[model samples]
Target: MIAQVKLAFGIAAGFGLGALTVQALHAQAGPPAYVISEITVTDADAYNREYVPLANRALAESGQRRLASGGRTVALAGEPPASRIVVSVFENLEKARAAYSSPDYLAARAIGDRYGRLRIFAVEGLAQ
Candidate 1:
């Protein structure tokens, strides 16, 4: 009887350790996120010269890295795409939003508002 009890206790301990390890791994593998922006610039020159630099600075400050940016887009499907598309990666959704909402970025965005329209979204990335 004592041997059986010891074996049961050992099994329970093993399961507990396994659960902890899985939890730790999950935490360590925190998923990344992305910020996507579709822009249609009415005043291209103003957006490029005045807004881009300031926006980049703010995004960097908030730990966002521009993954891709382009002024021209070719849509494979769906309705016509925006004139410009930009994708930025961040640690997570919160950081992405924070970057876009930060004062510096907001200021840059205001300038862009005067020159264009923006459609922005945050998306959670696949697990690493």
Candidate 2:
């Protein structure tokens, strides 16, 4: 599934971002990847106690910068959004994926699994 998503992302990049192929983009070290996570905590206490610290450590180790976190989400249209929205900026999609799957994050994630429902996605940002 992830492979398919990456393939689609590459195709979109080839056309949408102009002459820069995936290799060229990586070679030139273009824009970073932004990971957006929307979370609804079923057990706020457990999430705060068991998940936050480990996840923070993983993010720090991965050098991911938090753009926005623990922000209330407002939905102008459609159903109500998650209770909290988190956006983290990573060096690239690969880094973001690695950080998400790292042992630290995985351990934290186990706790979250019992406490919250998450919707996460990553998009390559516009070049700086």
Candidate 3:
């Protein structure tokens, strides 16, 4: 009976340690990052024609998932948003930064700048 008790205790301790290890690994992995862009298009036709496709392709190639784009935003507590808003999610903050500064995105931005005003930023999301 004593031997059985010891074995059960040992098994419980092992499982506890395993659970703790998994939690530690998950904590270190961190949370996702979000990129938000607020755009006010001066010439919609030109912006869509020259900038949209290139920017979309660049972002998609960089492993970003578009969460929201050009949706109606009703401001609840602050100033109204720009004419268009785009939100994207990346694996992490590092990847978000990389995607924004990449050559392809930069090139697309160069074209986008000609037809619109853009404000872009990234924020770290809460861990799930």
Candidate 4:
């Protein structure tokens, strides 16, 4: 029984140490970056047909994870949001900026602009 207890404790300690090491490594890597886009569509059909798919592909190819897209939003305080809101996460601030300025994204944005007005910005997320 004592030997089993010791073995269990050793395994638990090993897992705890491994978790700590991972946290430490992640801390060194810095927090992730998030991109928020507020869009007002002038032509819904055109925006959905032309802009959304292309933008989705570009962002996906750039390693972005879409967190929220056109969901029902309640304003807790301040003014309400635009007609559409999209939130995405990237590995880092530099990666977020790169993704925004990439040729694929730019091409998609060109098409998007014709059908909608967009306000987009990036912010660094809290460190884990």
Candidate 5:
């Protein structure tokens, strides 16, 4: 519950600021792009299977617009910093944060506790 709240806040605050930053820097051609890696650490494939579908449903429901190319990911194998499911996205920091709000993202996150310690991080200043 606590982690979910933090994730929600992170998305709202991070993206709100990121959007503002983009607007402030509108002089640039476009929003500074980032390669977002929505990842989770897990040792069990069962966890991955369960989480991915739920998270996908949430993502489909939210409809948060992302300049991003693809979608979210679920942990496939191993453990944190080792095994992970990485999804790709191209959006400002604000959008990055917002993506977490996706039912897909949140659902996936919830199942995280079913496994070992799990987490998701947005890689700032990334590409591809």
Candidate 6:
């Protein structure tokens, strides 16, 4: 009673399911540790070479750390003057503090603060 396509799909799915191992459910070696989400002032301008480069470098370093640590990611963005820069570095409190202490991040934070920082905060997150 099954159409050819339906029958073929059923057999394929059954075989696929049967072949799946526990490894499938545990694709990643472990859960992610943390994530950092950053939003800069909306009025940010790429023309500001000094600021732009610092931002670029910060994101680059954060990205590398993310990959090597096998946890979360750091994402950065620029908003308008009316908007504010928001950065959330998710991880163990100690690790997050350590990241902030890094010279590179410190420099970027200085630049970002000059732009805007209305109601910014860091909180705990269950990395996954």
Best by TM-score: 4
Query: 25-95, model 4: which lDDT tens digit per residue?
Result: 98888889999999999999999999999988988988899999999977789998899999999988999
Cα lDDT tens digits, model 5, 18-116, are 999987666453443343343344456766677656765655554433343224434467643334434444345566667676656766767866764
Order candidates by lDDT, high to low.
3, 4, 1, 2, 5, 6
Model 1: pairs clashing at backbone N, Cα or C within 3 Å: none
lDDT for model 1, please: 0.88
TM-score of each: 0.76, 0.74, 0.80, 0.81, 0.45, 0.39
Model 2 per-residue lDDT tens digits across residues 10-45? 998778667556657667886799999989889999
Task: Give the poorly placed runs of model 6, Cα more than 4 Å off.
Answer: 1-43, 46-49, 63-91
What lDDT does model 2 reach?
A: 0.87
Provide the lDDT at 6 for model 4.
100
The 0-to-1 C-alpha lDDT of every candidate, in the order given, reads 0.88, 0.87, 0.96, 0.93, 0.56, 0.51
Q: Whose lDDT is higher: candidate 4's or candidate 6's?
A: 4
Model 3, 25-122: lDDT tens per residue? 98887899999999999999999999999999998988999999998898888899899999999989999999999999999999999999999999
Model 4 regions more than 4 Å off? 1-24
Off by over 4 Å in 2: 1-27
lDDT of 2 at 34: 98
Best by lDDT: 3
Residue 100, candidate 3: Cα error in Å is 0.4
